[model samples]
Target: MKVAMVASHYPLPSHREEFVARVHQVADAFRRTPGCLTADCWLSADGDAVVSTVHWESEAARDASLATVMTAGLDIGYDERESRPREILHLVAR
Candidate 1:
């Protein structure tokens, strides 16, 4: 199963460049984890928030990854919005 996490920051007072730097560093860890097939993240162009889509070997792997990501202190409404996990339908290759 794959997990798509959308973390919405509630309009923090911090500077844009500072927020992006922290978010980008944490996002990098997702790419280096074992069993992580795909990990990609992007900030909202308006500079409000960031979201990341991560693919794992199995549901267990997905769950573990999500836990780790949340622990890093990103501004995610974990309690407000439910976490979502979906099975991958296809993967295109070059």
Candidate 2:
């Protein structure tokens, strides 16, 4: 089954642009991965957070690519620069 991973990031005021740029980079990387269908980053409706949504061929593919990217130094250190921990959600098509 196809899967989607959604992540919400709340960066500190000073790091907002940097965080968004990093998320965009991550989205771009995901798009280049073998099993990714599509990936994009967006601002939250309230404009207080950045969100990244990535669709994958499967949950396994998403996990594999996540491991690959993290080890490849795509980690943006959200915990260090964000105002709070990031939020993540996994979804599947109905």
Candidate 3:
């Protein structure tokens, strides 16, 4: 079954644009990875938050891709830019 991963990020006021750009880059990289169906990034209207949603072929595939990406350091630098820890949610099609 397909799985969707949704992540919400709240960047520091000074890092909003940089964070959004980095998120877009991460989404593009995920889109090119095997088993990734689609990836998208959205910026909040107030410009302080960003959200990313990625769809994968399966939960196993998502986990594998996440591990690979982490090992490769292909991330948005959330630890440095975010005001706090990001939130990640997993979902499946209804």
Candidate 4:
């Protein structure tokens, strides 16, 4: 079944643009990955959060990509609050 992985991150105002750039890079990489249907990154209207969603052909595919895609060179920045963990969700169509 198709799966969508969604995650939202809160970054300090100073880090928002840089964080989004890194996320966009990762999303671009996923677009070339096998079994990745599509990937997208967006900023919250208030610019306090960055949200990303990557659609995969299956749950297994998403799991498989984690090993590589996550290592694609982006790191959590110091400006990101440690107190606030990312909110993530996995979804499937009803």
Best candidate according to lDDT: 2
Candidate 1 lDDT tens digits, 33-80: 666777665667775554455566766666677678768666543332
* Candidate 3 lDDT, 1-94, residue by residue in tens: 9999999899998988777888888888788778999999998787767999999999888988777676766655557668989899999977
Pairs in clash, predicted candidate 4? none
TM-score of every prediction relative to native: 0.53, 0.90, 0.87, 0.85
Better of 1 and 4 by TM-score: 4
Tens digits of lDDT, candidate 2, 4-76: 9889999888988888899998988888888999999999878789999999999889898887777768866
TM-score of candidate 1 relative to the true fold: 0.53
lDDT of each: 0.54, 0.87, 0.84, 0.80
TM-score of 4: 0.85
Clashing pairs in 2: none
Order candidates by TM-score, high to low.
Answer: 2, 3, 4, 1
- What's the CA error at residue 40 for candidate 1, in Å? 2.8
Q: Estimate, for each residue in 8-86, the C-alpha lDDT of model 4 and write its tens digit.
A: 9887677777788878888888887788999999988887779989999988888877667877776734443422678
Local error of candidate 3 at 5, Å? Answer: 0.7
Q: Worst 10-residue stretch by lDDT in candidate 1?
A: 79-88
